[model samples]
Target chain A: MFEGVPLTWFLIVATIMFFIGIYGFLVRKNLITILMSLELILNSVNINFVAFNKLLYPQHMEGMFFTVFVIAVAAAEASVAIAIIINIYRRLINIDVERIDEMKY
Target chain B: MLIMRHELLLVIITVILLLVEIFLPDNRKHTIILPSILLFFIVTVLGFIPGPTGELFGGMYATTPLILTMKNILNLGVLIIFIQSVNWLKKIENKGKIGEYYLILLSTLIGMDYMISSGDFLMFYLGLELATIPLATLAAWERFKEKSAEAGVKLIFTSALSSGILLYGISMIYGTTGSVYFREVMGAFNATPLQVLAFIFFFAGMAFKIAIVPFHLWIADVYEGSPINITSYLSVISKGAAVFILMIILYTVFYKIALLWRDVLYVTSILTMTIGNLFAIRQRNIKRFLAFSSIAQAGFILLGLIGQSQLGMTTVIYFVLVYIFSNLGAFGVAGIISNVTGKESIDDYDGLYRTNPLLSLTMMLALFSLAGIPPVAGFFGKFFLFTAAAQKGLYLLVIIGVLNTIISLYYYLLVVKAMFLNTSDQPIAYFRSDAYSRIGLLMCVAGIVIIGFASPVYEFILSLSHGLY
Candidate 1:
């Protein structure tokens, strides 16, 4: 079944995942949920990279190298973000983004 | 081997600073200063050493003299930020995280250096994401402040959106052209409609980082909510580095589509200037006002990009250097004033000249420079920008740019008028800056004045742009 999948299928799946991430990012009220959306978007990017690596440039693993770096950085980013979110929770007692509008005009 | 040694030295210094901060007591963590300064010196020296602009890691990493100069400028900016933040950091109740702040800032700076020097798209995206994600956290460093949290949310959302668009554009380009290296893309581009569409998407994403109009809504709120130091970093260094990279990428990858982008940029220039100025006119919050004005200045930089000539690159880089000092001077003054009065409104600046003549004069010079008035670096910056635009026969864009400069002067002068002209109900208390911030501000003021008179600096920038392409 996987062998029958065309390159266009990979693009379509990636696009779907990207849009879902966007939707979650826009609709979610909690900071953590929004961060998860960001992660999903990143994962979609990784999928694109791997797919292109497999199909377009099999001789070189440039896309795979980028994917590894992206994963590593995303891990670092998520840890820092979670720490900040926890700090915000301690201060405000909630993670709802709408309630954090104290700075907006 | 020598270049690798230099890179290794930088890595060691950065890691050692990080480790030293982890072990130090909260109060004594100020000792991180010695290493920070040492790292700055090392990076500066490394930046000047002549080396071949060779590709590393199978053509992914590339460095040139121009990229080295850009890195040096960013290092200098980060050093100033470190010095400027000393007092501001001391004032924070939660001082334990101070070392972490420096570490993150250094990492972001490293990422930016890589971003500008990157010849391949893979490294470019990696560097961009690394530089940006930390800034979103920095926006909310004041966890107790609700606005800070809001700013963080807005920044992350916008960044995620733009990243998605940028990624899609990158994928499309790869699909159509079968390459991710910039030079390869340029070699393969046929000016197809799909390629143009991809370029537009990529440009739009970059425009967000530069905070040009229509992509600028988050800027004012983010600047207001973030710690003043971080806001200064975002407004000047972050945006400036992005523009530097964008200029290089466009010059290399999309020279074939210059005519199309020039027309698009011409209209963007007018709209950005008009909108940014009109919005700036109505802002009461000083940070927000400067934020919009910075957006307008981004539009002016876009005018330089439209020229797409060697002179245009020189003008853009020169203007960016002047802008670094001018905007940082303004923000530094704002930071000092906010520390003292806890007020951030234009009206609250009433009778500031009476309270503190030195700060008032410094601020006046900064504002004058920002408005492109005579005898200040800002004037020369705008003059070069207009000259570059006019060289491209973008007479209409130049006319609008000049007119917008005049409109911008009105609002900038309003702050001056408040400080010198308006009467106060209560005497504004004069506050003293620590030795470091004072020196930083003095250096910025000195740079503004001296760089204006220094013709060789302009010539150097022109030669550097020629070297870049």
Candidate 2:
């Protein structure tokens, strides 16, 4: 149980993970690494949703439903992302964001 | 069940299309195109039939006349895109995958319908994800094209990042209000610091989708790389859907924080308009030019939002409708040219009037409409949006809007000049556009001309906007 763990603690962890994900997203070059960063961002939000549901409003399952949907959607998104990464790799022989500037303004 | 008639019809059609896709031979794939368009046409027509409107699934999904109207507008845009894409779909490179395009396209439409109808955060997120993920695949549609693949990657990356940010905001709202339902959240929402932070995140995420200035970096590249058909869809249909939902949420759920969001809109609108116009002036690729122009259009739509009244809502919706016609008209011409001649740069369009006078005319009309010139629906749309803002005593924003309109007219005229005034040693040769493209262009022209002169459409939208807030 999450008893005796203050909500602020969970909130603190999620916030850190979210920023770390954003940092990775900005700093990383490879497509898959950026995707992993996206996952980190999503998972951190998942943590926030779960902690809020279980701690703040124990009666309603709204946040729980939201978490389930997020997990499902994130999985779907990851699959799509991988498919796109593979497609990009095939066409260009690399997935580095730096190298993928074929259509820049 | 009746409340979501539009979504239900689209789902049925999608299922039928899937069944057809399963049974059809790979070589015979293009056979599905006509039937798919015909079926979707029926669904688009069915969407307009008056239907019962109310909540279902425990207040998660709801509908209203205004929502119905928005869905209808989207359906109209998709129908035009479908018609216009027939020529592109018939290409040798796109031969075998025609059915897949229709199926994916329909599913995304279904997603947008649900997104527009969503009454809760959960439904909204689901609809939003369903709407977006497949679009990345479509962006990468020409898998053999290097730029298309890159577009897919960029689109998916930015969308995933934006959605993550948006979900984080929703989680915060959930934490603060203890509910995700819009009605409940609306009652509980206040201008607390955490709630305001949540709103900023939500706005940023939606802004990325709408391609608002600060978050608009992904747009030009994605638009330039994707096929012209997909670019137009992204600019008009996808962005329009995001704006509709954002407006709905801000007006209904975040009305309590009006003062906060108005300030945000004011700053973003100015930056979005100025930056979009400045960048638009430099773009040579027609798609990227329109991309920046659409960003400026989004800024203008924000002026309507800042008004924060029924008139604002009406102008936003009306302007979006007018925008669908004008933007698509411009893109349709560009698309047919690109498909036929493989030329997409503004310089390539020189002396277009000498060879393809009709397309040049269509492009001119569309560009003029986009610049808010008189005798077009766009002028009326802009006039009303300015009126809405001026009603709110935001004269400064309105003036800035008018100035931007003039600047936009200048750049738009540059394109017009290339077509009409500038002579090229080698003009694009005349070739008649196919039947479908003509029909598509005709529809857009008809909408542009009729929607402006016909006062009933505006009055109808005004009536629908009255009780929405």
Candidate 3:
């Protein structure tokens, strides 16, 4: 019922998840791992949306609708992105972003 | 009801085109072009239809004649990109994906159109994400190229970070204002510290898309790595659309805090111009150089925003229109040369005039326009921007803007000199452009020259700004 916990707790949890995703994005070398981190980041966004939908505007479900759309789009994006990553690996045989700096100054 | 019909039409056209692209035979994939052109033409016509500005979906969606105008300009730019890309797409190894590329580009364009019309924070963020993620994929569409992959990674990472920051800002604003509607947020704006912090975060996120100074590192690298056609999309249409939305949001929602944000913009504008031009001067790769040049042009556009007047809005719109043509022309020429030689460096252009006078002349006109030479739209573009800034009593910004213009001229001339003065060791083979690309370049050239002299074009822009408020 979330009776004891304040609404801010949900935001704090979302923020923590968001930061973890950012850390993974910066640290991970594998392309797929970095992509997983991006998913985590997007999930944190969903958490915020759900929390706001419950706490701020209980009468309207617009935030919930937005979260649903975000999830659908993220799934589509991840599928296409993974396919591209696989193609890149087949061509180049690696997914290390650092070594892929062929066009860097 | 009319606006709704217009939006519905665009959505239907986009979905139909996407389906046809997905199912079309590879050899017959050129069929997608007809639908795209038709859709763009329809959207352009719809944009001109007069109607009342109002809200939909419980005030989350808003539309005005000005937003329609912005959407139409973007559609026009996208159509130009499609035409210019056809020849370049034919040369790429995986030519079949050209249809998919157009689809993604159209979908992203739709997102931008919605973003400009969104009246609430939720829709705005969704639109931003939709517009950004596909672009990241487009940057790396060349699966075999390591540079392309790196560009995609960089873009996605930066985009994710900015989205997080922007989300945090939105949360903060909601916490303080208890609402995310633009008008509601405007009513709640005060000198509160939370409001200031939220504004800073919001500015930083939007600044990343606009490629302001501190956030511009990804631009040149991405431009160099991406295919020239996609780079053209990134440089002109994507950035221009973001600036349009930013202008609307800042002017409508955050106008009361203009005094605070204007100071932030002033410092950022000067830094963006100086840094962009300074680095642009040293780049050897034509794409990278133009990347920085585009960043510097963004700073000039920001100068217009600092004016905070109807004149400023009109100037910004006009400059962006001119920029769409000038920048696209430059990239189109670069695309032609790059396709032929697989070379993007200034050195490769030596004796270009001797090899292919027509290509060289187009390149010359593009660069001259970019340098703000007379009889070209870029001159009028910069003139209007500086005039807007001067009206705001921001004379120092205008002076720096002019100095930066001169600095830009030096580098652009360097490319011209290479093409005209130096001789190559081997005779460069004359490259041929397909009918579509040639028509595209001709269209851009015509836009640059004729639009420069056309008073009615300026008048239309003024009328659009008048409708904004």
Candidate 4:
């Protein structure tokens, strides 16, 4: 049982982490850093899932399964993101998010 | 008896395409496109075959009439893409690496197939990721172009962000209902704040996929930078898949909570359309202009969600059917002109009809359909959507929709004016299309023209849309 840590605390921490990721996403100028921010956001969701699974449906283990899937997807997404960033770097020789504004309207 | 007929078909075709590439002689590698197209053409026909429809894999995958028809429609879209892409795909620059294109394209189609047929949250999430990750690579398929790579990065990053938000919402829903299966959650959910919040987050994620107004920042840039073939794929098939699944979840799982989200949709619909039109007017790049126009079209499609009745479903299906042809025809013309002349701006299209009469005329018909002109497929589609909304007594939405149509008309006609009336010193010269591309263009033209006059497609769509309620 989660004797000491309340459910609200877990929810609050996860929410905070999610927003932290968003803040990082907004402020970071490097593609790699922005991707890292995205990872943070996904991880926060995983935390919420795991916590809720433990709190509610401990018998089914649904949330834990979702967490594992999220982890796998995040890995796949990160790899793809890194590949694209590298592709950009190869062409432009810079990975700054600001410089990636070439096609913006 | 695997029961996943459509997904299996997609996979078998993907494997065959990939396998064919390995054995192909270096000089004849591009010939793989022919087999791939032929195979897709077969699948499009096979899609019409009746198959058993029910949940398989312990309720993870479900096939219904709606999903079957949607899958077939998507197959048709992919088939058209193969036709439109062949000549451009076989150019010398695309020589050896052609297999990679079809492989990813087929993989994305498979993902979308599963997404449409998915019966639970786990499958939905998996299918969505499968559909999304390959697209970034496809957007950046022209690796040498800086803009292509940029588009890929933006696409992946934004999709990742949206997926995370969506998962958080899913977690909330799981917490509230203790399940992710549609059937189970539908019974348990009662519009709790947590569940409502979950739906909101989930909607926002899909809205990003559809490139709705607030989350539409990446669309113009992505469309501009991506290869024209992939741009058409994104505008039509990808969007159609998302809309198909979005309506499914909304009408089935979220129906009980409709009152709460209806207002949310109303505000976003108006904002999405107005902003799409306003931004579309100023776009110089034809691809970016279409991007905004598609965004506006997304807003119009959202009107279908307002009613959640069979007529609403009918309108959504019909409109999407028309859009797949209309948008692709326009992009195909743009692709043809740009492939020949390397022109991306509207100014480059001035007096295009003087030389390339076929391309210009097809472009006019497509644009006219998109503007919802009478006697085109698009008009009936929009008419039914408006009728659906009006039946629900949402007259304000219909009125706003009418005004947005006029706003959209101005820009769509601008292209027509530039193509027909405006004259340039040097016009784009007439070009002969390959037989396949001609067939593809003719197919779209046929859809734009013939579908309006024919009631069979409409009736078929209505039959498929049945049983949702």
In terms of TM-score, which candidate is strongest? 2
Q: Could you give the interface RMSD of candidate 3 in angstroms?
A: 2.7
Candidate 2 scores a chain A TM-score of: 0.95
DockQ, per model, reads: 0.45, 0.90, 0.38, 0.89
iRMS for model 2? 0.8
lDDT of 1 by residue, B1-469 (tens): 4433334555667798888887888779767765676676777677667776667876677776667677767776777777777777776564687777877787787778778878888889888987898898889888777778767767766876677678767867876777888878889999899889889888888878888778888899888888888999999899989999999888888889888888888888888989999999999998898999999999898988888888999888888888888988898898888876788888888999998888889999999999999898999999999999999787888999999999999999999999999989975787777797898799789979988888898897687777555
lDDT of 4 by residue, B1-469 (tens): 5468888888898888888888888998877878888888887787788878889878888888888888888888888888998878877788888999999999989999999888889899999999999999999889788888988888898888888888888889998999988888888989988788899999888888988879999888888889999999999999999999999988888889888878888888999999999899998889999999999999999987786788899889889999999998999888877776789899989999899899999999999999999989889888889999999999999999999999999999999999999999988877887787888899999989998889899888887787655
Q: Can you rank all candidates by TM-score, best first?
A: 2, 4, 1, 3
Candidate 2 vs candidate 3: the DockQ winner is 2
lDDT of 3 by residue, B1-469 (tens): 6666555666777788778877887788866665677677776677666777778988789987778778778877887888888777776485677677866887787788778889899889878878988998899888777778777767776776677667667766766676778888888877589788888988998998999989888899889988999999999999998999999988987787889989999999999988999998899999999999999899999998998888999889989999999899989989987887788888888998998888888888888888899888889888988999999898989999999999989988998999999999964678777788898899899988988888798888787686545
Over 4 Å off, model 3: A7-11, A43-77, B42-46, B49-53, B467-469
lDDT of 4 at B4: 82
Better of 3 and 4 by lDDT: 4
Candidate models: Cα lDDT each: 0.82, 0.94, 0.83, 0.89
Candidate 1 stretches greater than 4 Å from native: B1-10, B49-52, B92-94
Worst 10 residues of 3 chain B by lDDT: B1-10
Across B86-154, the per-residue lDDT of candidate 2 in tens digits comes to: 999999999778888998998999999999989999999999998999999999999888888888888
Candidate 2 Cα misplacement greater than 4 A, ranges: none
Q: Assess every candidate by TM-score.
A: 0.94, 0.99, 0.93, 0.98
lDDT of 4 at B398: 94
Model 1 TM-score, all chains together? 0.94
Candidate 1 at A6: error in angstroms? 2.8
CAPRI rating of model 4: high
Pairs that collide in candidate 3 are none
